[model samples]
Target: MKKNYFFSIVALLTVSLGSMQGQVVNGTFENIKDNGLISNWGMNFFTPITIDAETGETTQDFITFGCWPGFVFPSWDANHGQHAMQMTNGLNVTTNTIIPAKSILFNDPKQDIPGWNPGIPVDLSDQVAMLGFDYKFTRMGNDIAEAELVVFGTDGQELGRATVDISQTNTQYQYLYEPVQFTSFGIPASIQVSFSMAKEGSVPAFGSTLIVDDVIVSYAALANDEFQSTQFIVYPTVASSEINIVKGSTAPSGNYNFTITNMEGKTVSNQSIQLSDNNPFTVDVSQLSKGIYFISSKGFSTKFMKQ
Candidate 1:
């Protein structure tokens, strides 16, 4: 009878694992149809953005007056109509419409370097897992580009930041996984994610363009077993020199190996710690340079900056 009981337990575990594997899904912006569900999405700058049904390209319909012209200002007009000022490309033109690419070809004779700022905000307090789609610049003069995933509180305070670099030659899509606890942001009221392409100092030209799609966000199933078990809390997240770790509920018991690495994958600090129940530990970052750093524990990690 004992032997039979052991076999039964093994079978049950196997079934649980199978269920979990199917629960893990990619959450990036490929298109509305590709996403399991879209919480929110938008394009900056132009108005009444058009989306190519076949190509999945997004283009702006209006023009801007200044360098940061795309929707950043409400007064400027690409057209005379009031609603004609769409937010497909700028800050002032926030609208709900599809963006087309053929309208503004990267290599068109009129093409110049166009700037973009697209983002999505979600309340992940009820969900634990998150994923993001890849944005690429296939045929641009400048190969170097920047993209960022930002987390903000309901009060508009930034909780965390993550940035990634893409190569102009990369043809395949790259996805980013963020296994984080929602409570760390205190309470999940508002979170925003953004993507942009432009020169370092100059404003993006009208012709310069980038392609973005495949945005997916979902809760990880229990079977994946990859769910973040460590509940990491960093107090005064916007720290200048020193920051305290809140080990209240998510702090793991026993020995944990902690490592801090910069964006270039260089380790700055690594140490082992014996964490007590819900005890706080402090790390002095005063001596470190000001930039973004990844604080990783076990298999889970999050980003923080030193100002």
Candidate 2:
């Protein structure tokens, strides 16, 4: 039963074709088909391949099968346009496991076919900082919905990644912006954006829907600019022991509260610093574990790495 679920997920990365190019297209979910298919994106649905006994020809039958009414569909609860994409968590009766509706800028060639590669073509001509989207989530129990953005180099090495999760129930749409932290190890060539109704360990619950719209590739900093730009500059993104927060030209001349959080959004350190002079303010991060961490004051945020 678990093996069947494994193949089903692999199918998601294999289905889409030619139109999967560059940045996200039809992000508004406005180009939905009558049968609930969205253009320029891939949604998970079951359609078995059939072969003709007489002709020896194989073809995919246009049959949509899944949890009733399918797991993904178009909804009128849009934030930017007339329609938005909705994904719900459903139970796979045969396997008794949760089947999540997923939408992705999916890649090419069927997994059963030769030389199959998965992921969307990315064009980073612009200074892309993060992914921004508007969503409304109705979570059940401890279930959570998440969205992720990943950048891959030409050699298939991960260049950067960012993720945001919806844990609380929100009837009204809320805007979310998540940063993509680059490793500065390779040249980015492709990217993949995915949204799923629930993450691992989420208890199966019906009607836990996530409505998403206006998915945009944000090019500017996802955090506040005044402090991140003028007030201070978090330098040496890849730091070993310490990170210098240099006061910028228009830095506010006063003490402020700052916190450092890990990628899981857990605050590991809470401290205050005075920013009234030209000398750089250094923060000791040697005690923190090696991984990605974010530093922010008030609403201004930025990220760094502990090497």
Please, what are the lDDT tens digits per residue for candidate 2 over residues 1-307?
A: 1111112222222123343223255667777554445544555556445456666566543322233365666678876557887777656554455667666655443332112243566654534457767688887777788888888888888888888877878886666767788876776677778787776566546668888876655533222222236656787766889988876678677887889988667899998888876787899999999766778886665667676
Candidate 2: regions farther than 4 A off: 1-23, 45-68, 107-118, 220-307
Write down the lDDT of every candidate, Cα atoms only: 0.39, 0.64
Q: What would the TM-scores of all predictions be? A: 0.35, 0.55
The top-ranked prediction according to lDDT is 2
Which candidate should be chosen as best, given TM-score against the real structure? 2
| Candidate 1, run of 10 with poorest lDDT | 9-18
**lDDT tens digits, residue span 1-307, model 1:** 1111111110000000001121212222211212221122323222345566666666544433223333211212211112111112222234422222211101111112122322223444334244333333443444344445455566667666555544454433333434333434454433344444442442333333444433323322221222123466555444678866655365556776779887566899887766677677888888778755667776555555566
Backbone clash total, candidate 2: 0
Error of 2 at 171 (Å): 0.5
